[model samples]
Target: MGLAKQQEQKILYISPLSLGDVEFQERNLGLPVRAVNQEEFIERVFGHFKGHLCVFLKRADGTPSNTFYKHSEKERMYKYLQTTFGINTYVSYSTFYQKVKKHKSDILRTQSNIVHTYMLVQDLDYYKFGMTDAECLQKIGQMVAKGELICPTFIVSTGQGYQLIWLLEPFKNIAGYTNDLDWRRIQDHMYEQLKELNSDSVVKNPSAVTRLPGSRHNKTKNLVYGFLANEVTFTLQDFLWFYDIVPVADRSVKPKKLNKKKATVTTIVKNWNEYTLNKQREEDIFIFVNVQNERGKSYIGIRNWLALVLRFHALVSSDNDTEYAEKRVKELCEIMDMSETDEEEILRRSLPAETYYKQWIEDTWDRNKYLRGGLFYTNSRMLELMDAKEDYYIQWKMKTIKIKNAKYEAARKRFEKYGEEEADKHTWEAFQERRNEKLASDKADKLWQLEEALDRHPEWTNKQLMEHLGWSLRTIQNYKKKLHK
Candidate 1:
């Protein structure tokens, strides 16, 4: 647990939909030296007792540790018990092993047998509850026997009081949740109901951790064990008793006014863009990193996202034949500081798409805002699939071409109608005349080179020069004619 806390609660990090289950798993920790899978560990803990189980431990310092350590077959943890000022002291910083077991998100999402509610019994509050710890356990056993309240699957007698855990049945329908917002709704409803009954004390958040069975309480120094029955199971429907426990709708005296204290913590920033990609979002194959019209903002996280987008584009858009994809890829390669050859190999490699492509897209969308409509196409789903459906690509393409000469308008129209190849070829001259465009400098440089070559190699004919320069004879002849004029 300490290690997990250090890594921003890595073990506890779960899909919002799974938060309820994560909290439940936190509470029902296995009171043993070694941790095992959820089911086996639950079985071992609820099974018949063998020896003293170490539930909690503390270092020389008084700091509390959220973990339980040690399991042995002999000398029930009594050896660790100590008399402190006439009172037995066993553990301070004590915790049991807890693991969600399903490390992969996909597998864990499918699991439904999440603990819905947890019950905590303590001796410290017997005065308020008006029942001794033993009396409370007896009443609980009676309730179970009569089927009024569901029997707790596992019950532990902590030195201070008693801890009872009731497990809910598996709920298979866990997907398609709306922001994982409703998993704890039942817990809240139950809490309100308990408040009406004035026994809200028993209700604890599903994330709450109880004292590991077989461990001694730190202050009480008494051993903990299963109270009544060793094993049990109940349906989620069984929890309806909490509603009946209070039954607030009645003609009665006025309810007491409850005072509330609220604490506010301000956060400088928050990312509300967390999303799980559906099949459509998953198939969005290309992410074009474009500079927005506004000032460019840079961050290390966005830079890494840019690299990820480029890599995915090369992987999925590799088969696309459009000049649009090719041109965009070239620009992206330059921005990435990778050579065209490296880009080609990345495109040609017969490898699977990134395993975390969906995650990358979600993360990238949140971090960067330079994404433009040029990345997405306006028409043709097939073209969208071919070009990654970025909203900025066509918008950018339109904006860029219009800034050039009017002659390029027809080609832009042709691009919308006849696609990249015909459009680019038709717009070639206009593009060449526009200083802002790539073709203009390219044509100028070619003409300069031809003029230099004619002076240096006067003996070479136009055909030989054409062969060397990979230019058409017609183009060379035109250049020479222009030179003479």
Candidate 2:
């Protein structure tokens, strides 16, 4: 028969734990052998004979020792296998010890007994067949190209001493294990090889490799590429680059609908023109009287006077002779400080040529023209000035609230000193006295000044008169009524 097909040879190796040198009593010979600590001895003994034993060694009761051992001892043992036996030996540590303990018997039974070692060695040899530096680098580069290892991974070295390094991305994982060694050497070699491979082509292209599509990546090409043609020098450019790369989602933005209701510009302009014409007529009536008094002219310009009169009546008539017209006329008379005769003259000039004062009055009063819209058809500027006055009044009212509150508080305190009935009687008498005093003082100090203004500017209309006196229409009217009375 052809030489018995050599049974596929398999080897089992086990490492002893906590061994020491001992002198045997019977042989009087010093022998260095494998011994395990008492705690580990049971597991080690079972590991040796559990597998087919081509060779085996055991040491018992060798020396008193703890788990700690010298590095020299470990190295010496490792050296024995590598140098004398031409075998690679891996020293088992705590991690390997735990692994062996879990599968104690299975490892021993399946393996051949060629190696002269215990159960621990058989278990640890499984991981000892690790990849070399070159093989490890190749795997890391492949992982990076596939985008499997974008983050850092670790590597360990068994030569010289136990060392570890963390491999970062870009240069691949092998750069980590290089420690202090120059990795640029490896990089240079790789670059040269890549260049040689592309030498035949005018346009050098990267080799095809699988990678997840980055936000900046072109999926159409299976090659590495850069977003920038050159390096960025400015800080703003870096920000712009990052911003451009960020993905933006589409969203619907609707335009807002405006009011778009056109204002009544034509109506406003027409009303404004009419208001100006009426105001001019009022001014002419005042001016004509002033001229007559100053020049000692007995006769008036009838046409000019009648024209002014018609304009005034038209304005008053258009307002339907509303209550506001009466009020405005009263304010005008008070502001202008005109005598009854002077008022009569102005009204006469404003009336129709055929109509007498009595009939005009009857017609105006009967038709209730003064009770209609009144001066509502006035200029927008006048309305704006009125609105400003209203705002000032509101502000004054707000200010008065604080003053009133303080006065009330003081009154309350004063009243508390007297009985409630006596306090009410005294407070009312005092309030009346204070009011009379204030009224009298206000007329002398403020109303006199307004009167002087009216006397000096007899030609002014109500609005113009109020402006000259720097007073409100209401204030001027009140003072005029008091002065006339």
Candidate 3:
């Protein structure tokens, strides 16, 4: 689904009680190393959320256990956790409750079972990288001052590391709503934005738990406490700006120069362009490489290989919709002429290894996996893998394979007309050089268009420019900085 463009930030209407007593008490608070007790911190962070809450705690027998309780029973839950010394506690941000399903009461916490997520979390563990707490805090301060990072609503000190919380107006997680995808995009963007802060990548899952504020750190024996940064709360749209941004290709966001003692934080962005293929591209490649009509010479063991490919795509494309995914996988298997036995085998394999499958899918994030550090196979390598004939290229829909074929045709024509010397200009290296030149030209044209729009409407506000030119507020600010300078 296409994400809605964010032209401006929108603040939710926060009630006085929703602001909590922590914000009231800390009206004059600064970003100092202050901490609050268990009760106050928990209420301030989770008071707005409704229904049953899920938490992980250490039992008296030293076994780790997770439990769900009604919001009114929170006091009892807290008592249970506090009874055990050095007991670590963790909490999930997704709001859930007990429901009667199939004549049994169950505590549901799956992605679909969640009503809404009241906050997004960033697990910042600087100590893992040998940085002290004070050093990490100072770097965060510098980043905020330079407008390089968004100030989190609150910060939790987990004895060894920190958890940054961005409270949001409860965003619905229903199937029909677009919030689920937008929420994922926003969370992923935040992870990328704060990678320099050693943000934990795996904590972005909706039902994933992190250290609970006011809980004890098992190893350090220090109490985990939270402090107020501000009373700021956001709606889903407030974070729309980040979702619409595309990371600059093969380039790092260089901060302004500073001396040794005051160096700016260097942002080394992963050029996703070089590392990952989009969902459409991956699906097209899978079909072109594996699908066959009659299954003759390539028919030997092709059924097993096709089943694996289909299962992989189902896991990635289903968006946690298990029932739909199951049905879709069966339909696809049938279309590919796989027997019912093959279909059942694929589902059986998938059921036992959902977690491991997710890990395998993420392995594409590894920069050293494929050609030029891409997550998927290159067109030439794909062709090599399938032993594809020239006919396969003619039937392909995605541009990657078609572009490869075009280059081959171009080179053949050039060599026929003007010998090997002129054909050298159409080689891969020369092709890349020409592509880079075109990209640069397009960037210049965009900047020129922005400048021209500003000249025609000198009195226009940022909002007006956004509405007129269809650029994000951040994009407009960036262009203004460059054009004025």
Candidate 4:
């Protein structure tokens, strides 16, 4: 015998006319040209059909409802497909799939045994009031004949929450079995199922019921669950949808208030300028010395050079509001008796302020000695040249020289009085001698105290004797040895 083969049914998909275009055509206006192909037409019909069914049917329990208008998961999936295949294929697939998924739950629910009693009654009443009682009964009978009865079972165990089980008819006419079926009938059936399911209670017997793991409703729930478990990839559409839901806070986007206590560089410069302007003075020496003291240089010449550089810088910027950098340079050159060429050379050699100061100090120190007029010299001729308080200058010089001489003398005496090895040996000997002398004095005092303690407590043992005097065994023995000697 040969196996019987089922014939494939060929369904002709009619593309849906736009409501606006249909209205225009009814008024005898020219209609828009239809640009869709057979495949595109089929896809559009299927998508619309699926969407209609989905809207009518209730979303399966345990699956999250689509609260936001923009589908985040679908968008991400579409992008992934586009990257993998091609943009055209991704667009076609995404458009069709998105429409189908929208009404998938509704269609599946209509096929199940779970009929919504509320919608059924409502529809029956509508027909009765709109038409005749006979028409209402006739419609009701037709629905009952085509409808599948679903026995829903819910279970709750020790740990697990209530689980729902829906027992559906093996074969029945779903809401939209054929394209000829009325959409109103389909919606009524779906609503009826929802109402019935809501009224259903959990079943007690766990063994009697056979559990079908992956039903249409369960599969839909699982698909949604998996999608949510993965991170959601948001698009611009998603952001707009979010904005509609929750608005951003004003304070969050606002700039922070700045601290009032802080002072800027501009303020510091302004204050310094004002102070300088207030302290206007007559002709100052403006001595310009190149303070260069580094790499084997005299401290005296370096100090003088530093003084000159500092004075030159001060004089140039002394005007406060106005800068006299050029004038200061000319005055500095005149004071130093430097020619134009020399001045240019010096300016070129000096890089940054710190580098200039360093080089100047180093150069001055290298050529000079500690003369009586230098910074190191208390009674130097340079100090006499400057018109300042003689007493104050004298005092400062004396103090500085005294400190310097003391330090020098100390270092010199240490070297001359003792050789390296002898110095270390003498230091150690002195320390040891002082330690021994202190120890001897303590011992003598303790001996006298011990004698008095013994006289007061004659019955004391050696341990008790040592304990009372806070002496160790070795110390007590040594004291006894000294007594014997």
Candidate 5:
């Protein structure tokens, strides 16, 4: 990870229930601030909005704790939280209770995995001689590269301190996950490793939650934002580094070096020409927009979201899958871990799939184009909006939730005065303007990239260059003629 993305706004959640209330605690991010789940919390941690979300409450002794309440009791917990205080529902970093196995006396022990790996965004209160944020980051970089320590996936500047969020790519790096008890052991191992570097012991427990990026620090009066979403995502080796895992080196990543005078492939994007319905280009555009691969990422609700995206494509392109889209969508969703009843019941047939699709496509692909997001960035952006993270069925407002587009103008406009009348009225207009600019900018970016490629390999023909750059011969000719002039 190069640099972790910072807080989207300057705001911290304040607990509604005081010490007397059942769910009240000293300091919680007032429950789910910006994250739909753990990954979003890690990616775009900060949001300024306030909502009633339940974080894991601590024990009476003030010790950090993680408790896996039963599925049947979740509704009861929700009602309790809400009736006592004005909270919406429970939002947790951990997974829903899953049965691991049966024990003696026919008892079932239910446990859920910690879905998101974390970095304590701490201000080093324990140490008298504390390091600056920059120094801490530098020291971490040095430590990881030494072939000794597990590298952090990203770093966040909390305004008060820094958070080195741990890396769990493809969601499998941290294995041997059985239940909450197992996770506590894992957390303890990690805490022990980082303790030498001044990791705070108080919040190191498995169930602890941090504020989203935009949440304000009441004490410091400062806001946190993305310090960096590291360009260097962790490998199995990095995770293994924690367990003292060895012998097998993780897959090597070739460094993508950019030319000093020109932008790199990471910065260049395809020009938005036209999306002609049913044409090969349309099909390609659909695939390009929807199916971009995000290497080494496995998050919750993946299959359901894919079904939604693919179903939208089927519905829009009547010639394709129009006959059995509903049936097929259920099938696809099932393959991705959803139950048949869930596909039918949870995903209501009467739901506005079209409006949802348009909203999603516009918010995501449109946002990505404007940000000049490349493949990985674009895919990551898409992941943030699926299912619960999406705004289609917005039950409660969040701090930051627009995938990776939180940094762009399209996202910023909504946040300017978020819940205000102006934000509501002007949001759509601003979005369309940004989309139009992206359409123009992408074409320009493409041409610029083409020219840089041509300049480096002068002897190459237009056809060869077209093959190299995945451009059409006509497009290449048009650009060449324009460049020649």
Candidate 6:
């Protein structure tokens, strides 16, 4: 019983902040406030943001190095905040870990890992400055009150120190790189401004994770808590008022055109043995293959995605000299566990190697058409089409695709209950279903017209089909194939 009492005391010591404490603080701090509790704090701060919100937890029983790390959508991370409240908790101020494992020790918490940053934080260790927590808080309040400092969005009292957070509209990385120069410049300026208060300049990077509010500071034996000091979310320009830095958001930087000549199916296949893929291209292929192999389910969209990947690969791989990619796709039908209809559908949807080569060049080489395909399959759209699971994305370097898929599934399920809610009837899925049905009807009508035209002129060339039906070369050819079969 004595041992049990000690264990109970330890648990309470770790998580001493109760709901009553939250209420008492809220009542005492008479202000137009927010974040009465930890959950409320998380929701108010990060509920709207997408991408990975990392949580770091260090337990009393564990060594300093034995910290727990988790990354998930901000909505999902709310649960983590509750589950890890007893431990010493910290959270990435910006959502980092773009393309990595859901949970791994090697998970990136570097500046490069920061996909988007929504806040700038200043760590004020009052003890280092020989000040009390109340004195530090009163000082910050006085600074804001006197217009010496802009009001922080929230001020977290970290038991011994304070963290002042200035929430901003998302400052996303440009072209996969953080706006390092401008970001750092702002950080430096902010630090300089608050250096009198002993603001730690070291924690100014985009990767910095702030100690979570409403968690126990094991050494200090005090509860960490925060309250909203300001409601307005600042933009990048707002900070520029204090810091004399140019706004990185307004830069009209175009992607640099590579010096290499445009790749053609003929040229690539002719020099297939000598041709080599760059690191980016190789990585793309590797990720695609890994995603397919791990999922092990060849849905229609999944198979078409496979065909698309192979179409690019075929331009550099040797086979039957011509149309090798298509042939290879056919040979793999049995291996892929695809039905005859599935194979035929995949083939029908698959564009030629030349077309794929053209699109690839446009995506990689042409600045205006960078990463744009005919279907405009954005990362999230492609993931949804593949019916990707949360685990499949770890190796693919994708961020927020799992969260997006979840949202899409939720929207779809909501759409299914159309009669229950008026809003559900107008969902994107419902609209897409309607659009697809109309498209199918239109295609059937067009096919009937083409069949009639073909019956009248049985020996009609593809040129004749184009002239008669007013269709493109590829469309007429596809219709011709359909008519013949």
Q: All candidates' TM-scores?
A: 0.27, 0.14, 0.44, 0.14, 0.29, 0.43
* lDDT tens per residue, model 6, 1-485: 21122121111111123333344333433223454567666666666566667666667886432132333444455665666666787777776656464677565666667667878889987588687765666666555545456667776878778788877767775442224545566777778878877989776677777878878787677888886656666655445433323222221212233324444322122232223232133234345545465656334324555555455445433321347656755655544545334777756655554464555445543433233332223343334334454333332233222344465555545544643346455767778999999999988888898889978998998888889788899987777688778
lDDT of 4 by residue, 326-421 (tens): 344444554453422365543432223333223333444222211111112122222322212232312222212112244334433544567433
**Which ranges of candidate 6 are over 4 A from the true structure?**
1-32, 60-80, 98-107, 174-178, 246-485
| Model 6's TM-score against the true structure | 0.43
**What ranges in model 5 sit over 4 Å off?**
1-93, 97-127, 170-190, 202-204, 232-238, 241-243, 246-485
Better of 4 and 6 by TM-score: 6
Per-residue lDDT of 240 in model 5: 28
Task: Estimate candidate 1's RMSD in Å.
Answer: 27.4
Estimate candidate 5's RMSD in Å: 25.9
* lDDT per model vs. reference: 0.36, 0.29, 0.57, 0.28, 0.39, 0.56
Clashes of each: 18, 15, 0, 23, 30, 2
Better of 3 and 4 by TM-score: 3
Better of 2 and 4 by lDDT: 2
Residue pairs whose backbone atoms clash in candidate 6: 99-397, 214-224
User: Where does candidate 1 stray beyond 4 Å?
Assistant: 1-62, 67-124, 127-130, 145-147, 169-203, 228-230, 235-485
For model 6, give the 10-residue run with minimal summed lDDT.
Answer: 6-15
lDDT of 3 by residue, 358-456 (tens): 444444333221111111333453343344534432234333433345755665566667665576676678889999999889778878989888789
lDDT score for candidate 4 against the true structure: 0.28
Candidate 3 segments exceeding 4 Å error: 1-34, 58-62, 99-107, 175-177, 242-485
Give me the displacement of residue 291 in model 6, in angstroms.
54
Native-to-model Cα distance after best TM-score fit, residue 237 in candidate 5, in Å: 6.3
- Model 5 lDDT per residue over 1-485, tens place: 22111111111112122322212111221121111222344333312212112344333355542334443444564454344232111123333223333544431211123333323233233233465554555555555445344444334445466555543332311232222223344455556666656776644443345443434444455654433323344322223223422112111211232122322222112422111221222232223223222222222223333444455444544433444446546555443433223666525531344553344334443331122211112322332332233331121222122233443444445645564345644566777998999988987898798889978999999889988999899988888887778
lDDT of 2 at 334: 39
